[model samples]
Target: MPSPVGHALGGAIAAVLIAPRGTPTGSGSRLMALRARLSHPLVRLGALAGCLPDADFLWGRHNMETHSVGAALAAALVAGLALRSRRAALVTGLAWLTHVAFDWLGSDDTPPLGVMALWPFDDRFVFAHAYLFEAISRRYWLPNFVTHNAWAVTSEVLMLAPILAVLVWWRQRGAGPRV
Candidate 1:
């Protein structure tokens, strides 16, 4: 499956698009302001939520029930009830959905082919093999970090960084914090 870069970038995109944003303290560049804004607790929470569904891998389960739409709905419902804000639930849910969408659109050359996106409802593994994303390197951390994974992640960054830059810049220029 696609690695953390795609997932994290997806979360960052969600944060930029949905989270309340304002100018940051200090005479920092817009990029710096973006970094600061992304550090906000709510933005970070959204970013974290993007990768949270992968936690099912902890028990040797990669993409079964947790990768389903049901899981996203359950997350949104729980987050809405716990956070007492529909906006929070929406951001959290969108962040998670971004991950699933990326995974669904990614190229998965590994066995089992794709994620069980409709698990518990439809047990089929779904894959687009669109190559919009790069597959993770199944090597040791250091080696992978310097090689296939690095290139893959760089591709993700190259694809996303400009969009993120434009989004942040537009948000800063157009208005104050949005709901």
Candidate 2:
């Protein structure tokens, strides 16, 4: 599956696309606008959600319950209650789902072969077989491990960077009233 970096990027992209725009009235520097967007509570929560599925790794369950839609819903509900905002909950849930989406599009070299994305509904694992992102290696002792993972990260950046650039451009260009 894709590395945490890719998952985090996916989450950020989801936030950029789904979270309501909060650009302040009047004009501002592109960097400041981007900063404001990134620092929004919903966006930060979305980014956190993106990497949360991997927390299962701490318990030796990498792609099981935590990677499921059920878990995403649960998370969303909890976030909604805590934040008192349905949109925040939705953004968080979608950001979490981006983790599953990235895993589905990535190569998985380990056993079990795919993510249990439909866990509560169906215990079956699912994989896209698209191989858009390279599988990340956990074997840190291997000599080539660093280089292999570096290439994987580079590929992820290549794929995600353009989307981020476009988001920044769109936000900046649309920050002011259009008339």
Candidate 3:
């Protein structure tokens, strides 16, 4: 299966393309970034919560809907309700869908063959291969999220460093909070 980077990279690309194009505003950037960051932890927790189907805690074999489209959409909608930012929700949804798309393309399995990302909406799924093969056996594929498992819990703290630094700098420069 593809790594989180692969998933997020796909998300980022789709976000760039599908994100609303309007006056470049800090609010938009903040919303997009937060949506992306927030989705990560949410997806992780959702997996742990057993709310996400087809997901195995150790194996990482799960449907894309849990970690991608459905989860993302749910998160975005909640964020939108709380923050009233439609753009944020849009970015989150797009990012999620992008993850699903990438998974479809990169995963060796698709729909009936593998994960069904567009379940309920569609039956088709993109199919590909694992990004990292077993270290001992290159023919076999490795699991995704291995890189982030240890650090997944600290994501918010990790994100805070840069977000705070930027915010403080912006504040010191007399630029008020945009959103």
lDDT of 1 by residue, 95-173 (tens): 7888778888877766687678776688887877777888776656554556888888888889877877777777666
Please provide, for model 2 over 1-179, each residue's C-alpha lDDT reduced to its tens digit, 9 standing for 90 to 100. 88878888888877777665546444387677777777767667878899999999899988999999999999889988998988878878999999988898899998787899998999889988999899998899999899999999999989987886677566545542231
Q: What ranges in model 1 sit over 4 Å off?
A: 21-32, 141-145, 175-179
Instruction: Score candidate 1 by lDDT.
Output: 0.75
RMSD in Å for all candidates: 3.1, 3.1, 10.0
Arrange candidates, best lDDT first.
2, 1, 3
Best by TM-score: 2
Instruction: Provide the overall lDDT of each model, using Cα atoms, as 2-decimal numbers.
Output: 0.75, 0.82, 0.44
lDDT of 3 by residue, 39-132 (tens): 4332333222222232433575455456445566686687567657665566556656655554444424333444566554764543545532
Write the candidate numbers in order of decreasing TM-score: 2, 1, 3
lDDT of 2: 0.82
Q: Where does model 3 exceed 4 Å of error?
A: 18-61, 64-69, 109-112, 121-179
Clashes of each: 0, 0, 7
Q: TM-score winner between 2 and 3, please give it.
A: 2
